[model samples]
Target: MYFLVMKMRSSRNILPLLSTMIQRTCKFSALPELTKDRYPNVKRGNYSQIDTKHLNFFKDLLGETRVITDENECLGYNTDWIKANRGYSRCVLKPKSTDEVAAILKFCNENLLAVCPQGGNTGLVGGSVPVFDEIVLSTSLMNRIISLDETSGVLTCEAGCILENLEKYLDEHRLIMPLDLGAKGSCQIGGNVSTNAGGLRLLRYGNLQGTVLGLEAVTANGQILDCMSTLKKDNTGFHLKHLFIGSEGSLGLVTKVSIQCPPKPKAVNLAFLGLESFDKILMVFKRCKHELGEILSSCEAIDADSLAATTDNLNLKSPLEKFPFYMVIETHGSDNGHDEEKLNRFLSSLMEDGTVEDGIATNEPSKMNAVWQLRERITEGLIHDGYVFKYDLSLPLENFYSLVGIMKERVGKDAVRVSGYGHVGDGNVHLNVAVKEFSADVLNKIEPFIYEYTSKLRGSISAEHGIGFRKTKYMHYSKSKEAIDLMKSIKKMMDPKGILNPYKVLPQ
Candidate 1:
């Protein structure tokens, strides 16, 4: 297979053929049926159904084009990114401005109608979609850049602004957003904040809690809470914006965001290296941090099985010889000459000390992107392999790769592929298991075992992905009863009627 892939790489036509084969191999003929019955405990709240009066109110508030009633058109809103969950939302409301959102939510609160605030619909968990007949309030149409203070590097934009578009705008201003993800093209800044999305740049720029200066969100009662302060250091009272940062829209509907953008780096470099084992990978990471210092932006790792899955599914050849583990180290600095020199020295030291088996480093933009594709596209390639059971965890670096081995042994023949990869610099590992399809027996073998191992190691079960509907039941595995009780109290106080996103984040 490797030789075939190498040969195909030599020709352009074969690449397209491989792509078509992959599409066919990964395509799902029909998604698993998802209904309220799947979650036996979550019965529909006693909320009023959408009637002509509600339709007229929405139509009058946001024109006929913005209010969608057609079931076919609402399909996109009803399905999640992984297609693991489905909803039956009958109406999708697109509000253009904060006032429009406020009006809609106010009416919904008065009428006892449940509302699901959606943006981009690119979330892994089923947080953005409705579970039953809740109204889908989409921010897709509210995408507008409101302000950018180039000197201060502060950006204030509508919550619906696409992340990639924000990055492009920042490129013009010689700045960049603190976050970068594979779904940046479709994920909205508002949604990013709502979920506290931490992507590739998280190792360097930190998470949304620090990057987001302020934001304006509408509560369940349609009251717009104005916390949109662009100031970097405002010692104001409660610092309420932090409440909504990772609340998953169960608290409020984020309408606008004020984020602090860091100046874009002048020089960027990436080093893709093949390591003999996880120990070697860890040694390289420690040495890289000591050597690269401030310029180190990202340090990620992928196991051999993950690389093979990616190569087979996407027809992407490994840049180096196959190994048990691979690390993609990146550097960002102000001077190209200094950055290149630092990266080269680090690579030379690793090779000389036998820390790295084989590697390739490049500063070229196109080549850098190609190297990143190997790491960023793993999630995309895994979807084709089979039904993927994904767990994003933050563990002690020593125990990061242990679970993959354990799961492989437990699942035995039932598992097709058990792969591990993620931002190793931040101790976050994405462990994915691919099987032929969803199986109750297979799940029983994996779940409590994996979560128990994670909890015993004193690690977080959810590193970046919020506890959407998927992980709501497992919250106890990571958090304490007291902590969960406090969270429930907050949720109750903020959204007393449970009109906000139901059965998400805090478990019922």
Candidate 2:
């Protein structure tokens, strides 16, 4: 009986071992092999590699426990959020304070070592991860809320604080951060400020450039430039904080941020409308603006392809019959009764005029959230559909949905799905093309042509997502030579060694 029991226990252990082996093999095999060689223009810099002395210096600066040298632990930092970009960094340095960040940059600069400053590592572009063996200076441990003023609604916090945590903290005080995104749970405020992330709330609160009152950043030479102000109005010289707002960490590393937070609305209402065409979507947006007015916090649009993908992947049925286009309009106000009255009135007018095929409006928290899930879950669903080539652009309102059709015709059979959805309130459309896998031929058909189409319309190639390495070569599509030259000059002046986020934001 004892022998039999031993045999069973051994069998159980062996089964798990076999399972683990199979998982590890599959995981490793699934990992895409993209190295610096793929980007032939980005040659390794002259910066020295990590050595024992360098490791000891970091260990001494930020205790041994904070320096992660294990290859497995560093893997998470080396890979981007989309798993499209991978790096080969050997170590990740987690610093707890602004002083630690300053000291690390100083040491790396003096040692001629390349460094990549990382926040929550939630960036969609390849900006957060390193291309080669650059040491990762992570701000994950520097998360601390410095202060919150109940009177002025100004909240100051460290750079690494998660967006959702900040929102929760503000909820207790009846305030709301001016930004909201799908990745709020994992994306850090520093990265948001770095990328100038414009999410669902931008249509209501404006961009971060206006909401961010002040910032504190560390230069490549280790100088701590502190402009941390909490005042709503400041006529400071040059407004240096604006430089780092959307710089994408190419010039300096943002260590602290002071932003203007608005009061949390007491009542929130959402209307999910199914329309027959993009023309109706635009008409609804204008009517909502005129009717809902100040209470209209968000006006987002989704095409049939996007809705179909969301329904297929999430298994969530649309509240109304599927149409060629869908619009999710949200209203926020101090009184639920007034907000709902306005939303209902607008919906009634739309339905009576035959502008909307079907629609649903709800103020109950559960039902309202169910409506939002359809729009917010589109990004997650796209990942499962296949590899997504996402393009966020600002175009003339009339020319917004045209590009999606143009691209569909261009790619034809190569693309599995071509969908369009975005913040229609602000004229930003997220054009996503899903394919079974990445293909150079597909990319060639989409590029220069799309940029040309947007440029001719006098629209921006990148609306919210910054010009990371992926879009560096296309800067000319949106900016003039003189503008790009000034950017290059500023980069050279700030980081002479080009050690901070090398081969990014600017073309080679």
Candidate 3:
């Protein structure tokens, strides 16, 4: 037996890859089937459809350039990132300021017209797009940075600011956004806050619930609710900002956001390891916490099938030789020497016990990023494989990988491949199933089974991805009847008419 470690050549940033993915998602052969037709059970609400009067009102308020009625241009805004959901909205409104958003929502509410608050249109579920003829209220034009307190690192920016753009701006000031995602290239800050996005860095920096300080939202009636508090500790009557944090834009449209950023780490390091089994991966995670402790920024596990998908579909080469499992571990700290030493020691201990079959460690920016691409680009690569059924789950580590094997057995031969990968540090697992094409029979075998099994193990069916249009029916598995009822009450109170993002998040 021989030990084989990999050393990869330096490459440019991840922009080329991100650009390719964005291009692929934008070009559609023909528009996807309308949501209303795809799921006939979902009846359109008794709301006024967009008429000439409505379009004229919007045109007068925001000028013709701001109000988009051209069908060809509106097509891009009507579909989701995965092209899984498409709406039949004939109009898309681009509001440049909070006052404009307020006016649009207020007018729509008064006219009894339902509206969908859209941002970047990168949502995994069908939450961002309209179901029927709801007017598309887009926030892409509200992009402006209100202010940045260098001392406290509190950044207040309009909701339309892109995530990658925010990170770049923060880098110059020695600070960074607490949460990051693969979709950061195109996902908007407002949408990130609305969905409460938890990405690769949640292992160290925590979720948006802690990172986001406050936000300003407009209700269905168009009332501006400003909860923009910069202070970390605000003992007010109610932390009202939370109501919209993960509401998925069903309650209201997020206009602006205030988030607390952490100082950028002076040093960073990554270790890519090859493992033999799931039990060994668990053992490594426990030892990892004990050894790496405070410096560990991320710990991700990708199975052989997942790695193959990236290499085969995306033409990306694996750094190391074939292995049953692969792990990407990263650390961020103030001292370079100290952090690298800790990581090296941790890898040494695992290798001594043969827990890690092979490994490569580095602090070089380009090489580290090249490895990061392997993990971040998995979602994009799988799309090229076939029709993908994605599940975001959180389960006890003891049985984390059990469901993947169970699914492969359950789906049998219809499935082209069943792969699992995600943040092990936090217990969120992304299980993706790829088939040649969509089949109701395959879907029937997958869905209720995945949710039921997750409930049986006392796991969350939706770990970080909030309950959007796709998972509304499965809410019962995760929430009690009382909980769901209470949620409905809150929806009624916040958005009485259900004008904002109808047929999403809440079950009928």
lDDT of each: 0.86, 0.84, 0.86
All-Cα superposition RMSD per candidate: 4.3, 10.6, 4.7
Q: What 10-residue stretch in candidate 1 is worst by lDDT? A: 1-10
Residue 94 accuracy (lDDT) in model 2: 96
In TM-score terms, candidate 3 sits at 0.94
* Candidate 1 lDDT: 0.86
Provide the lDDT at 341 for model 1. 81
| Per-residue lDDT over 1-508 for candidate 1, one digit per residue giving the tens place of the 0 to 100 score | 0011111121123221123234427754356556475565677888899899999988988889999999889888988877667888889999889999999888998999999899998887788888887899999988999999988999999999999999999999999999999898899999999999999978899999999999999999999999999999999799999999999999999999999999999988888887789999999989887889999999999998887776778887666766789898988899988988888888887877778777778887877887788888888888877777888899999998999999999999998889999988999999988887877798889987888899999999899988888788889989999999999999989888889988789877
Q: 1-508, model 2: which lDDT tens digit per residue?
A: 0000011111122111011111111112244456476566678878898899999999999899999999999999998766667889999999999999899998888888888889888777688889888899998888999999999999999999999999999999999999998888998999999999999979899999999999999999898999998888889678899899999889899999999999999988887777779999999998888888999899999998897766776666666654678898888899987777777778887877788766677777777777677888787777766677889899988888999999999999999899999999999999998877767799889988888999999999899988777788888989999999999999989999887988778887
Could you give candidate 3's per-residue lDDT for residues 1-508 as a string of tens digits? 1122532222222121112222223122345688787778999899998889998999999999988889888888888777678887899999999999999999998999999888988887788888787899999989899999999999999999999999999999999999889888999999999999999999899999898888999998999999999999998798899899999998889999999999999988888888889899899999889999999899999998898777767767666766789999988899988987788878887877678877788888878877888898887778766677889999988878888999999899998889999988889899988876666788889989999999999999888888888899999998999999999999999888889888889788
In Å, residue 490's CA in model 2 sits off its true spot by: 1.0
Stretches off by above 4 angstroms in model 2 are 1-29
